[model samples]
Target: MNTNPATIRKGRKFEQVLEGARDIFLRDGFEGANVDDIARTAGVSKATLYSYFPDKRLLFIEVFRQECDRQTLAALDQIDLGAPVAEVLRQAAGHMVASFVNEFNQAVFRICVAESDRFPELGAAFYRSGPRRLHDELAGFLAGVDGQGEVAIPDAALAADQFIELCKADLYLRHLLRIDDSFAPEEIARVIDGAVATFMARYGVRT
Candidate 1:
């Protein structure tokens, strides 16, 4: 919100408008979302909703970016950086895996792909708020760990990218392709554990 886009003023009711837009967009989606509903939900008049977002697509994109930020950046704060390398990796992987299988993300992915041609910003927004943010977070953490001699990652950025890709090994593609939706705890554990082991094997400092 205010963190980025300084031009877009955050009024006394800015968050209120966004909250309403989020509710309507999630419940009804881009095409189905109406300004009237968003305004009513936010308890603001139509003028207020229009004042914040001149177009519905803009509102939808903002909400999508907001959700992605919430999912990736906010959740990163909860991961205990002081934990052992393996445990820290597991914690990060666990959150990543959950997001991969989450309904909101799945829906966002579907909508982005479906409407990408018409609303090209959807892809860019997703990348910026989701994968890009996550990558930076992981890369920063790995670099610190490497500096501390806890890991042997010569290329922290590359290792971060690889770790994220490893977590997407099976379930991600399947779920995105609509092959499977069920997220079994055992399956998730397997993915998380394998990602951690593989990363550690490559980067873990030999004791």
Candidate 2:
């Protein structure tokens, strides 16, 4: 059982490349970021960078995927499964809205939209990593809540999507278009409140 220092160093460098690539992608976006700059930022050679990512498109996809995973997990962690239906929905909607309107997320979304026509795969990857995952997670949660007879959702997946769309409403679109770059805490709360109320009205089981 001999330990290889070369293997350890390669692993360390791999992580550094990912970290540096993520920073570059966030700061410069996919179209603006370059591999040479990424290599320099990561303190790695061009050969090493390409060995890990193969191409800039793959690197951008990896960065977005990692970010989506991190943000989704962080937001879901705020939810309490045991909480009341309205309370749980409110919390979940709040997290979803906040993430959707986040400056970094908005930038990534804009990049995906702007480039998707030329790079269809990037759009698909973004949707799969971000919205699709969130939908699946929310559907699972709603299904469990329905099982408890707290809600009357016939199609948990549809309900999940509808709830998320409701949460987004005009706010996400307005933000995306630069109609308004900032959302006050009260505005966020109001949007979440409306979404939760609308969802509960449709799906809640009355006594």
Candidate 3:
């Protein structure tokens, strides 16, 4: 990653376009968002926009992909390599829950779920870009911790998937459906805490 000024400026402009496109898509849905409106929102000419993204579909998918990547990266930052497996897993689960509660995540997740049928590419791109990476990173970490006999997971990938599912099941589906009920902080804490406890009961180090 070189730190050239021109590259930095272009990157910033591209990010601006993605932000604008995301806002438009959330407000108007994919079919209603126009490239010209995105360009105006980004304060760039349509020509400049094309120089970055060739079409609205690509731009829209990238916007959602970028949002997913941002959330994944934030969660990645919280992993503590030196911590015990159960502790690390608890932290990871908590981070996962907190990430979905963010406003940007709620909006982006809504768009991804709603447009998944019409824009399969967008959904595929999101899985490839975000959840796939998270799964890989989590599996890698679990392998390390398992090697230390801190956990009993025979297959880290399966364990990671299970962990994600258990942590996200109700939270994700409810949020996607716009369910009126909201999880209180205490409730969220309990959900994540219980998930981790159950995982440890199955996988934690035995005396």
Top lDDT prediction, candidate number: 2
lDDT of 3 by residue, 1-207 (tens): 222223322455888787778778877777788888888988888888877776566776677667767777776676776777777888888887776566666765566777889777667766776678778988888877775776877999998888877788567667656783478778788878888988888778888
Query: Which pairs of residues clash in candidate 2, taking residues 3 or more apart in a chain or in different chains?
Result: none
Q: Could you estimate the TM-score for every candidate? A: 0.86, 0.89, 0.85
Candidate 1: lDDT over CA atoms? 0.82
Query: In candidate 2, residue 22 scores what lDDT?
Result: 78
Error of 2 at 187 (Å): 0.5
Candidate 3 lDDT (Cα, 0 to 1):
0.74
Top candidate on TM-score is: 2
Candidate 3 clash pair list: none
Please report the TM-score between candidate 1 and the true structure. Answer: 0.86
Cα RMSD for candidate 3?
4.9
Kindly provide the TM-score of model 3 when superposed on the true structure, using C-alpha atoms. 0.85
Model 2 CA lDDT for position 168: 94
Cα lDDT of model 2 by residue, 1-207, tens digit? 122222222355887898898788788888899888899999999988876666677777777777888887887777886889899888888889988898878888888988998887888888999899999999998888785777888899999999999999878988988999988888898899899999999998988
Model 3 lDDT at residue 161: 84
